[model samples]
Target: MHLKNALQKYPRLIVRALVHPTGIFQQIRQERAGTVLAYGLVIVLFNLIMTVLAAVSGLTPELMLPMAIASVLTVCIGIFWLHLFVYGLGGRNGVGTTCRVAVVGLTPTALLGWIPGVALVGFLWSVLLLYLGLQELQDLSKARAVLALVLVFGLPLLLLALLAAAPGFSVAWASPGRVTWV
Candidate 1:
């Protein structure tokens, strides 16, 4: 029932996320956790399918099973990490606000990441949404929001770049017809 309802509502949500994120994020902030999280899962599942079928090898449950598990884990962990940074940086709101941002502010990423060349574009768009959502939805001060974003996203990326350059440690993506050594 919830899946059906979320799916039904997603068309509007997608347009809103793309066209006017601040308003939609404000709306999402008021949503219940279950519904928001369900929508997050749906987006992840849909993007995964699109990536697999449209850009990579055809639908393979074996690959999907682990990807699904990892994607869910990433979302859940990202929510907690975001909340920690948000609240620590003086966001008086509860974790639910951060959860909403993670769930809905990333809509473009979950929607457009399947396209081979546009994933980065979608990710940047999502980052902008997240920054706006932090202010509009959580009522975070500009400085705090910026700090939180840096802590949540910038720090990890910096760490990854450093790790990639470290001796005897490498990070690479595995794709169809290409085996990456890490």
Candidate 2:
């Protein structure tokens, strides 16, 4: 009876919780997407500038190395953002949220020595947050809510990790010479 009343009163609560200002907080609580985009864009732009520098400087590899490093870092950041956007966060807050999530999620990739590990952690964190947000909308019990969060967020991350870590798994995209390792 209480459940029925709650559902009738909050008919659109679930939808509201997945969109706009009401849900925006849940969608973008961490600001991860923004950070990743900023870092990635700066790195890519810097690399483009350096490529021009290399050309004007007579095509020296030495001159290109720094730019190359910067570009690689940027791409890593972008990848992190992508991971978070796709796997960690889930909602219907529109394209702005989506883009922000994508960019921010990628920022961790820029760090050295712990790229994969950090990315994995970020991914997990994102999933957990998303799960919690969804559970809040569903009004489930604490234990069941946590379980729901795990199932909703965990399976996708597991699949993505597998794909990423798999041998011969490749995603091709074009970038400036400095951005491409091979």
Winning model by TM-score: 1
Candidate 2, residues 25-79, lDDT tens digits: the string is: 3444443554434544643454456555655675644434564556556445543
Per-residue lDDT tens digits for candidate 1, residues 1-182, read 96688877778788899998778976776677888777777788888777667634543433444554576688788888998888887776788878888878778888987665687798898988888888987788888888888999888999989987889985465664353666
The lDDT per prediction is: 0.78, 0.44
How high is the lDDT of residue 4 in model 2? Answer: 70
| Maximum-lDDT candidate | 1
* Span of 10 residues, lowest total lDDT, candidate 1: 55-64
**What stretches of model 1 exceed 4 Å from their correct place?**
1-7, 55-69, 170-182
Off by over 4 Å in 2: 1-36, 43-90, 112-182
Question: Candidate 1 clashing pairs?
Answer: none
